[model samples]
Target chain A: MQKVGILGGGQLGRMLIQAGIDFDLDISVLDPDPNAPCKLFANRFEVGKLTDFDTVYQFGQTVDVLTIEIESVNVDALEKLHQEGKKVFPQPQVIRTIQDKRLQKQFYQTHQIPSPEFVLIDNKGQLADHADFLPAFQKLGKDGYDGRGVQKLTSPNDFEHGFDKPSLLEKLVDIDKEISVIVARNESGGMRTFPVVELVFHPAHNLVDYLLAPAQITPEQAAQAEALAQEVMLKLDMVGLLAIELFLTKEGKILVNEVAPRPHNSGHHTIKANGTSQYEQLWRAILNLPLGDTSAQSLAAMVNVLGASGHTGNAHYEGVNDTLGVKGAYLHLYGKKLTKPSRKMGHVTILDQTLQGLEEKIDLIKRSIKVVSK
Target chain B: MQKVGILGGGQLGRMLIQAGIDFDLDISVLDPDPNAPCKLFANRFEVGKLTDFDTVYQFGQTVDVLTIEIESVNVDALEKLHQEGKKVFPQPQVIRTIQDKRLQKQFYQTHQIPSPEFVLIDNKGQLADHADFLPAFQKLGKDGYDGRGVQKLTSPNDFEHGFDKPSLLEKLVDIDKEISVIVARNESGGMRTFPVVELVFHPAHNLVDYLLAPAQITPEQAAQAEALAQEVMLKLDMVGLLAIELFLTKEGKILVNEVAPRPHNSGHHTIKANGTSQYEQLWRAILNLPLGDTSAQSLAAMVNVLGASGHTGNAHYEGVNDTLGVKGAYLHLYGKKLTKPSRKMGHVTILDQTLQGLEEKIDLIKRSIKVVSK
Candidate 1:
């Protein structure tokens, strides 16, 4: 059996450990919190700071292969581990490129991948020269996480209110929808891609509500999205799974939004909808095993359980009885005890054979599900 | 969070720990082996003898709810814990009734649950008095684990090699096929049953090979099997999952064979084929949550990966690459390093909408998979 260690022990690492149990591999995880979700599941859970180079390098030395859930880990240590023949996935160079928006866009430009045009500003003073990108989004070139670092600018007024630093001003394109494609690559160079999925955003919150697998799009558009996602993986030449978020322009062109080189949110429905889940695929790829089937088992949708506003105590679910009764719905609570406003507590994957049935399931979820604290 | 303590930590306990991770429950397990399958996953893995009254009773004091993966545990301890207000599922009385074959058979006869007629023999000398059942199966009424306590007394010669003690000689029925139904019951008296599954045995090994869910039986037969299984749960008056193995006689009658009060091998397909798996249902019943749907997502079959004969050092599969290429196949390997002839190493589940497609998948598995050791 091979030993596989993970960089972070959050929900992604936790899910991977759950999936990895089926294989004849030893799984370990490193997280700062002893109470992390992956603490119990991983064969070994080491408490350490992910950002500390020594902590990550020391952990990497004990495993045959190393991969990550979060991208904010120490890349320098990963590069050193790779040099020591530890089989670091996504390659340290890949993370180094993605950690900064400026270099990520440069990599996209160099590879000629279809993406929205972006120009870099060294400081807020340089914002005037890049005024043509009004209605653009200014994302801090480094250290951005979740949805925090990016600020939408409908006008120059937005710039003064956002982070004043070296940033990439991405020209916002008129898009019909956002979609994602997850591609898996193994050490043997075997690769496969899941069908494109349409990311549906909540109307008021503007965060993703659920995703429809094999996005309801023209056959040509679906092909375009999948091909573009594959191109990104091939260009980056990274092992393990990569989730490419794309914007389907009103004109029907596919433009890359960003890429995550790990098991991702867009593929959460895979656990119920696909024969091979994204988490399992990560293990297969990094372990040099065959990539699993990425085909959808049915028309699938994923609904996230966000922490309820005005809740700030140990988490308690409201209306789970009514919600699960909807049929074909799988509630995956992330085992986090606390609840704060808008936190990603968990998600539900509802699968059906038809789009209408999927929506009915989704509606049932929205009406009956609430994540609160008591 | 609610604390759930399991009595054993074998495969069933390991799977429940895996399934329970999706729900926010603080899980713990008591197993003597430090390397128990559930050790890595349980929130607290306590090393203790499951059959020791003091150990079980003390462990039960720590958790709000108690359950078991194996039945040969200290029921007296569980009874005491129940008396003290700790929730013990499949309650001690139910276990007491099912643990003894004679008592179990009597319960069926009293409840009018169709079963093969049986006559109890107090000793080997009494076997001659019960000579009318010459072709009966002489099963020891106590301490039976696996296939050790039962034997087919086809002739007087066969009796020389069977368990010579107080036992029940059950009249053998002309069986068409063997099937199983999994019934789930909760504390609120709410109940549900999975689709009837056809259990297939390997002729050479005399052990189950795979089982097909929604067994290929007339709709009436399917309904009859499910009703009988539900009746068993109702008669036992237990709260937990019960796997009732039944014989479908040539005359089309559904006769009860035996029952297990926890998750069984027959329901393994539910992990990938049903809306909710049997493991998840156990937690839901024990935790007093709403029972999940038992509806099948597709036609399904599961193939057991028995350890190969000849070499045995550390377990390794010979041909996973070609087997998984069959697609729609989910391989779940128990984390056992040593493999010997006929030992269960793991199982592979193949699911499809059509039985024809399923057979093709099963054939692919049969030809390409071999559980071996390096």
Candidate 2:
């Protein structure tokens, strides 16, 4: 049996465990919390810190291959395991590039990948040196996800309350629609990319509010985006799934924003809309098995079900019955215990034979369901 | 949250766990073996005899709704649970009628459903009394599955090894191609049926060897078969996934063979070939959630991976890599620790845009893969 060890035990880890059953692969997961949603399904569950070198190393030793759910894992431990001949997908190098905004921006510049202009800020002293770059977007180089660890720097006064650690500043460009491209590659370099999807962020939370599959872009734009995403995969020498978040400017230019090494939240719609789900494709690519068909069976829209603000006790979903009554609306709750504002608890994917029909169903779902705390 | 408890933890139970995730429904499972494949995935797992009334009753109390993976479950306990107001799909009464060959045949006759002529035989002494019906097929239905507990009685000499218990004696069916229809219905009487699928049985095991979706038949014949299956569901008042197996004679007549009231193995192809998998449809029907799209997205062929004869030990799959090397061939292993001859371990489903292409791929999967005991 080929054993796979996952670093975190959140919903992504839980879904990966579900997908592992299809391949009959043994899975082991490490999480600090014993009641993590994924613990029940994985073949073996271990409680440990994701960033602890010894814990990550011990976990990696038990599996033939290692992967991760959250990106804040101990990279040095993974690098050590890879050096000892363990298969670490996405490669530690790729994760290193993505884990830090400075390294990621440097990679894009070195490879001539289309991206926004940015400058690395080592400290508050460095911010003054680049004072000309004021009114830029300042993002912490590490430990940032889902719109956290980021701020808009309008002047030197902003540096007084800025992050104590190093950060990167990027020129803010006016965006048309936030888009993402998910691609999978095998060890043999065979690549497959799903249709590009446009993301609409929640006005206040800045989290994905909704996703539109096969983003309504011109043929030329779609072709260019796809080519660029595939090229990035090849350049990174990545195996398994890679999700590239991009910014499409009003001027019709595409710029790379960031990339996730594993199955990203952006590709969750593929579970219901495409021939082969992103989880299944990730398994196939990691195992070097032949990939299945990647055609879209229908147009799909995905809406994130985050915890309603100010309700933070035990979790309770109101209007669940009404939501289920909607035609073609599929709900997935992450089996979470507590609910907090802006916390991801679950998601709903609405699929239809046509895009317009899906949009209508999505609108109904948006109005019908509320993920609250009781 | 509404919890569902399933009896029998096999591949069907495993697939139910996957669907349960999408529905955000909690599921518990009961199986005699502690290491049943679904034990690790279900929210709760209890090891007890499926036919033990007390064990089944205790398992039933753990969930709001109850269903079964196989029909051999203890009907008396389920009846008691039903009296207590717990929902048991394919009601205890329906299971009782379907469990016994004699009762099942009588119900069919009473409903005027098309079936072969048959008589009840208690022992060898009774067989001679019905001497005119000599050369009959004797089937002990109560505990029969996958061609077990069935025999072809040619003459009085064939009765030498008579049944130890009462059995159903039916006229031999001159089958052309065996087919099955999976019908799903909710408590509200809303129902849907999948396209008829042709079944090719293995020459020795008599188990389904291959299944071709959208059986090659005239549209009129397809509609007739679908209507007949629907009638059976309504007559039984079945409120779950019901799989009706049938025989198509050279005369193009459809004869009802039997029915399975839970997620049947024959519908596994729907996982990849249809808009909604049989697993998801079964969950929706039982929960009274709106049924999903059941239309076939593509033509598909499913080949069962049965353990090879003359080998019984630790399980090991041969030619898995070879089979997986083919495009569009999906292998599903049940995570069984041991393999015995004729035991169903897994299956491979090959899907394509056309039936011809699927057939070609099916042929390759059959030749390349061997499921054998180590």
Which has the greatest TM-score? 1
Model 2 chain B worst lDDT window (10 residues): B123-132
TM-score of 1: 0.96
What tens digits encode model 1's per-residue C-alpha lDDT throughout B1-374? 78889989888888888898898788989999887777766789999998899999999999998998988889999999999988999899998888889899999888988999999877777777766678999999988878878888987767657676778999999999999999999998989999999987777997666788889999899998999898899889999999999999998888999999999999999998887899999988877778988988889999988888896777778788877667678888888768888777888999787988988888789888787878
Give the chain B TM-score for each candidate.
0.96, 0.96
Please give the CA lDDT of all the candidate structures.
0.87, 0.85
Q: Over the full model, what C-alpha lDDT does candidate 1 score relative to the true structure? A: 0.87
Per-residue alpha-carbon lDDT of candidate 1 for residues A1-374, written as tens digits (9 for 90 to 100): 68989999889998998898888668889999887878767888999999999999999999998999988899999999999878999899999998888899999999999899999888887787767778898899888889888988887666677567888899989988999999999988999999999988879998777888879898888888888888899899989899999999998789999998999999999988887899999888887778888888788999888899999888889978877777778889888878888888889989787889988889889888888888
Error of 1 at A61 (Å): 0.8
TM-score of chain A of 1: 0.97
Evaluate chain B of model 1: give its TM-score. 0.96
